[model samples]
Target: MSDLHCPARILLVDQRPAGALAERLSRESLAATYDAPVDLDEVADRHRGETVLVVGPLPAEHAHAGGPVVLVEVDADGRRTSPWDVPR
Candidate 1:
């Protein structure tokens, strides 16, 4: 939904504190919010029929949703990238 046509509902999940990131994304008009200190497994059963975006230093997480489970990664320069950014 970030393409500007429709606003997207983004589930911002992190193991540690990520208030800044969540706040920034929300300002952009996306449904961005933080639900931290939650493991992938625990978050899975709680929310259904929504996209799950996991921002992690470790590997990806196991989640449940009607939509896709996206992996969000940030570089040292603070540039964010995702699986969709990868070239086939």
Candidate 2:
């Protein structure tokens, strides 16, 4: 079960949230949460872990100085962007 009051262990930022995926992730006992780009900052602040994996379209702004954030871009076809191509 995910603790809403505490920071999330995994933050899944998907423009189109997939119910099945979110549910599956939660079953693993990790505090997984669904969110959009606009709420990245607010959500990031609530992150119990340091890394964040975005599984859909890239957010307009997701960079923060609070901690290390890892954003992964996934296309409509479910193709993930290469790590080498990700911005520093």
Candidate 3:
């Protein structure tokens, strides 16, 4: 379960390396980290029970696990070009 007062851990699950995107997010005050889909179990253990906020597309297993997955596009200038919400 997620604790409202505790911030959720952020994960960027992309087909390509998201290092630049992660840096941009940091500049925007949204700190995030990236991990291979296969390393998700380690990530979960690292964060304990805190919710994991995943961005971009994920594998079917994580996609259906009930946490929100935000689809966003950040342009070259670090501006979000496309944004949409996927309801649980």
The CA lDDT of each predicted structure is 0.36, 0.39, 0.40
lDDT of 3 by residue, 38-67 (tens): 455454444442434344466654444333
lDDT of 2 by residue, 1-88 (tens): 3233434333344344346544544445533435444355454455534334445544534333122233433322332322221122
Residue 50, model 1: lDDT of 35
Ranking by TM-score: 3, 2, 1
Which candidate leads in TM-score?
A: 3
Number of backbone clashes in candidate 1 = 0
Q: Each model's TM-score?
A: 0.29, 0.30, 0.32
Winner of 1 and 2 under lDDT: 2
Error of 3 at 39 (Å): 3.7
Which whole-number lDDT from 0 to 100 does residue 39 have in model 3? Answer: 55
Error of 2 at 53 (Å): 5.6
Per-residue lDDT of 18 in model 2: 47
Worst 10 residues of 2 by lDDT: 79-88
Candidate No. with top lDDT:
3
